[model samples]
Target: MLKKAGIAIGLLSVLTGYLIHHPIPAKVPDPWLFQILTDVLAFSELMGTISERVGINRWWAYPGRLPVPRWMNVPEGMKIEKTVFHGIESVVVTPKGFAERKIPGPAIVVYHGGGWVFGNIDSYLPLLVTAAEHTGFLVMSPEYRLAPEHIFPIPFEDCLDTTLEFMSRAKEFNVDPKRIAIAGDSAGGNLAMAVTVELVKRKIAGTLVQVPAMQALIYPKLQMTNYLLPSYAQNREFIFSKDLIPKFWLSYIGLSSQYSLAQIICENAHIDFSNKQMAEKFALVHEDRVPTRYKQRPYNATPQSIPSDVKKLLDGKTKAYLNKMMLDERIAPLFASNKTLLHLPYTHVLVCEYDPLRDDGIILFERLQSLGKESSLQHLPNSLHAAASIGPFDKNLYHAKQNKILFEKVRDYLNNMH
Candidate 1:
């Protein structure tokens, strides 16, 4: 018994040591920082074991539990207010100079990202404060409800309401109703894009309300139907793709319990195409869409011609869950009509080379520009997804140098916006 106890204690100590030595992501550069951060933020994979054992609607929010160094904290001197926009409570950050301005200033509504299952307005304090301060714009971030509870169209519609309401009352916040832009990272980008789609639809009704002046999408997950994008193969270590994608997808569509089965079905479904139309559609994101350099052997680079075991699990119920998201342009703005996108504002899309969603951003940028819409695309070849959230405005060295450059570029893009 004594020897057994010692062995157990020894193993525990090793695990504790590993956890302690697991370098917390800093603003400075660390070779293992991205890999380590990916592990910490991969709540889906972290919870996968217990997920099958327990019957719960949700697990804890990852990334949020991680330390956000003091430097990443929202800046001081920005006056933050609590207000209701379109009946939904919102957190608004403004500059002290708002009182002196007679003309409405540029404004932005930043949607926080957490795979659409996690995060809130408060979770994005740094981005809000930084954007408002650097770009000299009033920042309003909506506390849109999350999925698996509030569900799909609810979150997207909430953002749409916030945009319409915020645009209508720009004078109240001393913001130029016409200069307003929407910005979001990850799932929030999905919302921002959907809002832009809504704005286009509304514009058709009349020429009364002006649409957003610009949209800044930071590595958004645009297409759910195509998971075999080049980035998905190159960045297989991406926490969201390998660790969390289908889990969040199923949850958003109210299929949290069937995640394991749904994940299999979805994964296989992407590679399972019998129709000629489907094959051509999927080919749009093939090697041609990828930059030459990102096309490499590290990923399962072969065309997804062979189906996985997921096909065996597909059933009527399974198809229903997949269709729940696959069918809605609101869930996947990649399906938005070209007519709706033609009227979208000048777009600034940021794609990180090491992110699975890299192709998504590139495709969206190409789509908008091809339609004659004004747009810009920035490729961060050295950075990873959510790099903007790293080292918040030079708090530490984690990805400090990279983030500073990206954030400054974003500010410059916004400053130049009409």
Candidate 2:
């Protein structure tokens, strides 16, 4: 009887542990474990569903929470204020509070990236606060409408409109209108670039009076045309999988699963002739740009035809956002005309060796240099895509060191941006 009772207790413990660690997969594989691990690393104050499993008292909890507390929470050198700008929410952090900083420091309107699906201003608060402290610039990170609910053009318009409104009220926020810059990571990076293009168009049409002093794009996904880049092929199974890419794309466009997965995999639905021509021009490279090592692997050049049903779908809502001119100069910064490139401000671009977006950054850097724009490029040899955000949580000292390098580089750039 004693032996049987011990056996039962052991089985129960194992079952409970499995249940705690494994829940239903949420889009990404093993989401529950990922969330728990990320929360453990970032010191995120797990609210909502996340709080139940990993509470504040876990062994992984450290010097503070995963995200370091703000200065106001600390003994304080700066005052932080949370306010909503025209119904869009923002957290303003400055050395002297919003009232004092209302007209002096350079302003950076920041946008956080989550593939247009999941991420909030609070998730990136640590990075933002650190940026403000390091740059002595007033940073405003807006909470914009995400996808599958709001869809494309809506998010773009919201970001653009909010920026214009912010610029209009710059004096009230204590910002230097001329020194304002826009920056974001991943999807937010796409939005930032898109906003810059929109600003250029508006400026040309006499609708807008000002534009950003500079634009900082961190591992930006500039085009949807190339699904077969070496990074996409090699690192597909890395943290961000190939299967997950289409899933997010569909979510971004608010499309249901009615679109077949096979069609997307073949690039049938997304690429029309114009998109194909654009992809062939920019993504296809000469022997010089293609590393000798990458050529050993096979590449398929036979383009797949767009499916008829997909063509019909494209004619609808997605058409207006699809710019054949994106094939031209404005969209891909690397392929933009000399006139467009010359006007861009002093730029700082960071590219990671292992990141899928490395080529995009490299191409853009080369283009900027050719145009003789004052541009700075920092290539982090040991880093990977998403490394900056994951660096703090990594147990490996190497990642921690990389994070320090990234933060310092950004700090130096912002400080020197006069």
Candidate with maximal lDDT: 1
Which portions of model 2 show Cα errors greater than 4 Å?
A: 1-75, 96-103, 262-270, 274-338, 391-418
User: Which 10 consecutive residues of model 2 have the lowest summed lDDT?
Assistant: 56-65
Residue-level lDDT tens digits of model 1 in 145-260: 88777777788889988878988888988887767788899999988888887777778767577788788888898766776666776776545435367677777777776665
Given candidate 1, what's the lDDT at residue 319? Answer: 64
User: Candidate 2: what lDDT?
Assistant: 0.58
Candidate 2: clashing pairs of residues: 42-66, 43-65, 43-66, 102-173, 102-174, 103-174
Estimate, for each residue in 215-277, the C-alpha lDDT of model 2 and write its tens digit.
877777665545556555544433323444454455565553323442454353444545555
- List per-candidate RMSD values in Å: 4.0, 8.3
lDDT value, residue 120 of candidate 2? 66
TM-score of each: 0.84, 0.70
State each model's CA lDDT, in order: 0.70, 0.58
